[model samples]
Target: MGRGGPREIVQLTGDRDAISSVTFLADGKTLASGGGGMVWLWDVSYLVKPLSFLCAQVGRSFTQEEWERYVPEGPAYRKIC
Candidate 1:
């Protein structure tokens, strides 16, 4: 049903108000969120495989130099994709 990993079902923008509530449907994959006097639904079944989702969005993994900037004292960068 999906490529796997976590995939963003939708991106909400232009709403100045904060979210008021949220509920997950019985199926577990459907989610409902309310805000700004409106309700939005999302399908979250793709979250089972987060790596695939991230790889698909970025098309490439982080480079050593870039990773070092965030984890300067951590282990060497390893490509995830």
Candidate 2:
């Protein structure tokens, strides 16, 4: 998180999982998390827009091999990469 600034309004949590890696979009409204074999996308402006939300999954089930190479543990409260 940016902390104590205009961009500090948003915060992210891994819950019980370990955070591996985090990526922010160019617009700063979107964020991506990767860890425990799963990927998540979040909208930071959820308060103003009900549609804004966070989405998560347990690894990339579509590409088993690629998911294994990227995230081998499955989903976690926090990212590990």
Estimated TM-score for each candidate: 0.44, 0.37
lDDT tens digits, residues 28-69, model 1?
Answer: 877788887788787776665644565677799867777677
lDDT of 2 at 58: 38
Model 1 misplaced stretches (Cα beyond 4 Å)? 1-18, 26-29, 35-37, 43-47, 68-77
lDDT of 2 by residue, 1-81 (tens): 243335433576664374588888777768888888888888865634321222223332335455466444434233322
Candidate maximizing lDDT: 1
Over 4 Å off in model 2, which ranges? 1-8, 11-16, 46-81
Winning model by TM-score: 1
What TM-score does prediction 2 earn?
Answer: 0.37
Residue pairs with colliding backbones in model 1 are: 4-49, 5-49, 5-50, 6-49, 6-50
Residue 79 lDDT (model 2): 31
